[model samples]
Target: MKILLVDDDPNILELVNIHLSQAGYEVIKATNGLEALAFLDEELPDLAVVDVMMPKMDGYTLTKRLRAEADIPVLLLTAKGELEDKEKGFLAGSDDYVVKPFEPKELLFRINAILRRYDKAVDTIIEVGPMKINRQSYEVSIGKKVLLPPLKEFELLSLLSSKPNHVFERDFLIERVWGYDYEGDEQTLNVHIKRLRDKLPEEVKIVTVRGVGYKLEVDAP
Candidate 1:
């Protein structure tokens, strides 16, 4: 696995690089968000560990850009452990947050946990009827065309298509796609579902189970 470590503190960068390298992950070091973004032009990492405060661009902004452009998972490091701070991180599209003065072991644990969740959810490639979902590249294709929905929308579609015709409750879908600590309400899920319905091909239908939840129904090809 590859990790992009972004922080202005040289000592912190060195410390994290040592541990991540020892843990069998290739680490790419960046002193600020701009440098980190530049790195994306060359190679994309599996995940990014970014500091909340940085020169040029803050972690929240960087995280948003990363999600919009590369759909890479992010772990934020902040000095404050306040709920508001954590909320902002999640809203900006971070997968996890860690306060400063944290143990390296704990950081490694959180990184592993996030990766495990992703690995369990994604199956590399999923094909239902005429639609093809590529989890690795985060691409959705139908026939000769390709579409790239937003990160959450792609995840939602992927989960539903993973088990065609199976009903997934709204709460379960939200928890799986948005994380258990997600503060958003069901309306957020509704919006994503609607967006997915708009973007996907007609042969792939997302069926609502009324009071239960939703499922994907693929027409016979």
Candidate 2:
């Protein structure tokens, strides 16, 4: 998914960007709330990560304005971790809150949880070939054997298996799996595809179409 990250600190921006990108989310950066607002005119992201304190405009006001215009989820990221600060964040229409100096894994987990709740409310267990993917639990297994894959790999596999044998172009796959805001090159896609191939069962194969795209083709039982 695409996430707008609004922060004044260049260090914080770079840190969050690296972690979020590694976790498979496309990130758009804004130095402050005003810059973030300008970005809204161009394209709306799936979610926004706003810092509580910023120049030009604070996160609360940005979140309020965002709510006034769009229905996207907003996450407040700042050093304020007190109850009152959290309450204020919610009052500003933020869907979640994360304190600064937080664990990258924790941030990623929260992002996934919020997106799962916002995007797909219902739980679904997708069974294709030998793999069973529990959407709600974010677990993938083949009968008794469980497969633990990185975020990008899991997303790529889930998407390809969603529609078996359907030829999905490279651009389409990147857009759906990585979001339009993705800044990574095509090499990232190739790397994730390789990881998924190595992890998935032999029967579950991702077939490549020369100069076209990819499809999930399952071997016969």
Candidate 3:
């Protein structure tokens, strides 16, 4: 698997990149959020490891952008150990958050946990009103009728439908489905949501939360 890593500190970038690369993942490195965006198109990684502090563009902004586009797993490296900071990371769009000066082994564990959740992700198909999400196969159906999801479509649908009323910040959706964090562009979320809407039952709705996240609401099936 490939992993996109963005950090301003050359030392941290090189250290983490080397460790992850040695663990058998192809690591793509970027110095800032903008550079990360440029790499997104050229190097599609299975996961992303990002540092919260950076120059030119911060990790939070970068993560937000990536989450908007795809459902990749995101692991955050935070220099601040404050609880609020970690909470903010989750709110912004992170699958897992680790404090800076973290143990490399612990980082590996968090990354693997997200990756290993495949079994959990696919174990069930959730139904809410007209929306049906097949967790095991990553398939989704609308109105109890078969609505075959294209390859990428299922991931997007599952991310939203799994949390009926919970507003999923765009970044969270991106990381959950794309296997990386956001880079700060919410338009990517808009596009996939629009695509998912096409297959959803007319009665079910996926609404935007203004400046926050997205929510999927449904009625009695």
Candidate 4:
């Protein structure tokens, strides 16, 4: 697998490159977000490791662009371990966040977890009541109208619809959708569920299981 590493620190670039290379991954290095964007012009990598602070363009901006353009998964690196910074990273469409001064092994573990989630197989089309979810296209169609949600929201919806009416525990959903090592709290999952609910049609319901978790229920025809 090819990984695009974007950071302003040469040492960081070198250190991460070494570990990723030793792990059998092709490492593509970029000193800044602009340089990273330039590299995307030629070819897209399997995943991206981005630093929050950079010259010319910031990692958050780069992450948004990457999601919009290529739908590539991003793991963000930040010096601040504050919740707000992590929230920004998630809202920017990052797949995971690793604070600065982190161990390389942990980062590698998180990368593997994220890739594993992405690699899971799902049906190409799932029909529940009036909705038809297309996993391959990342779209939900209700009759003639189609809705395109963010990646996280789409994944959440897809998982729920995969086993219609089956209750998925909050923890299991988090681990399956996000990485098992997800740093954020249940609020992140709640937010995505809320967004999915708002986007979906009335025939499709995402019911909160009080204390357990959430499940998808379709109105009886």
Candidate 5:
């Protein structure tokens, strides 16, 4: 998952970035709301964590502007803890709120909850060549027929399909599809990759980079 962290406090931004990165999430940093908007122009993140107070744009205004442009989830991070403050955050289109001076673990927990809620509502359908991968439904289909891929295979396919031709390093795929603490070796990943290849469409190929990693090569539509 990718998270955009917007805060005026350099210390807080660094701290949050470090924690989220350690937890296996990609973190993009912005010093203020205007900077965050500039980052958004380049690419949209999976989620945003905005500070309530800032120089150019406060969290509330940023949340409102973010909602106007994207459907991604926004979480307000602030020092305010009152009922009205939280209500204001929600009114500005924030999906969740976390007060400052909070435990890093608690913030991570809230982020996970917000993402789960978003996954339920967001249409996470990726179309590549002739295949469609519906992430929420955990269904992979070509035309009208669904491919019953095993759990690990499904995750592997989804990860590869998510980025189309982007190459994923061997170790990176294992860490993502399996777990960060996975003890298995590369052979396990190769076995799963072979199975995925057998089940996938002929036009879709999991190409191996000579010494780098693997990437999905989809035939033109």
Candidate 6:
């Protein structure tokens, strides 16, 4: 897998690159937000490590921009351990965050944990009505069989369709499917939901509440 490492500090970049690369990952280096944006044209990374403080643009802005187009996992690094900073990171669309001066092992563990949970979710799928949602394999199916979904797409479907017609507020959906401690901006859920709907059968709808949430409803004969 590939990882885009975004940090203004040369030392941090080199250090993480060495560690992750040695672990057998392809590491793409970026010093700031715009650079990271440029990298997206060539390849999509499996994950990112962004620093809150940077020149030209901060990690928050980078995360917001990238998340607008992709669901790549992000880990924000901040110098201060302030709650406000952590909250700001989430508001800006970070999947997770780590305070600076962190232990290398801890950072590695966090990365592993995020990826592991993602793998677990993708391995299981649910079947209901015309829709098939694989919770683990990230696959969804409809009609007489099941359809395979990749990562976020399957996650969105499985979460909504699991309950079948039960309305789930955006927050509720995000918390359960995206990981209870998930820390990304809520708007990302909208993008994922749109993708899910487009992939589902025409008769099966994941409904949206004008002022509230969403639910998956199967068409009745």
Judging by lDDT against the true structure, name the best candidate: 1
Candidate No. with top TM-score: 5
In terms of lDDT, model 2 sits at: 0.83
- Compute the lDDT of residue 71 as modeled in candidate 4: 87
The whole-model lDDT of each prediction reads 0.88, 0.83, 0.75, 0.87, 0.85, 0.76
Q: Compared with the true structure, what per-residue lDDT tens digits does model 6 show for residues 5-27?
A: 99989999999898776554579
> How good is model 4 by TM-score?
0.56
lDDT of 5 by residue, 1-221 (tens): 78999999999999999888776578999999999988877888999999999997889999999888876799999999999999999999999999999888678777867865675566588888889988877899998889767778987888788787888778667766665557878999899988888878889999998776899999876
Q: Taking the tens digit of each residue's C-alpha lDDT, what string does model 1 give over 93-192?
A: 9999999998987888788778757775657899998899998889999988999888889889887888899888786676667765678789999999
lDDT of 4 by residue, 73-182 (tens): 99998797899999999999999999989998788888878876675643578889989888888888988999988888887888788778888778767866776567
Q: In model 1, where is the ten-residue run with the lowest total lDDT?
A: 172-181
Off by over 4 Å in 4: 121-221
Ranking by TM-score: 5, 2, 1, 6, 4, 3
TM-score, predicted candidate 1 vs. hidden true structure? 0.57
TM per candidate comes to: 0.57, 0.60, 0.55, 0.56, 0.68, 0.56
lDDT of 3: 0.75
Q: How far is each candidate from the true structure, as Cα RMSD in Å?
A: 12.6, 8.9, 15.0, 12.3, 4.3, 14.4
Query: Model 1 segments beyond 4 Å from truth?
Result: 124-221
Model 3, position 27: C-alpha lDDT score? 84
User: Per-residue lDDT of 1-221 in model 3, one digit per residue for the tens?
Assistant: 67898888899889998777655457888888888888877777777888888888777777788888756778889789898888888888888898878887678667867875753655486777755677665566655477667755676666666668877766546655554433557676677788888767777888888877788887664
Candidate 5: stretches off by over 4 Å: 19-28, 38-43, 80-84, 101-124, 135-137, 143-145, 150-152, 168-194, 207-214, 219-221
Ranking by lDDT: 1, 4, 5, 2, 6, 3
Worst 10 residues of 2 by lDDT: 116-125
- True-structure lDDT of candidate 1: 0.88
Worst 10 residues of 4 by lDDT: 115-124
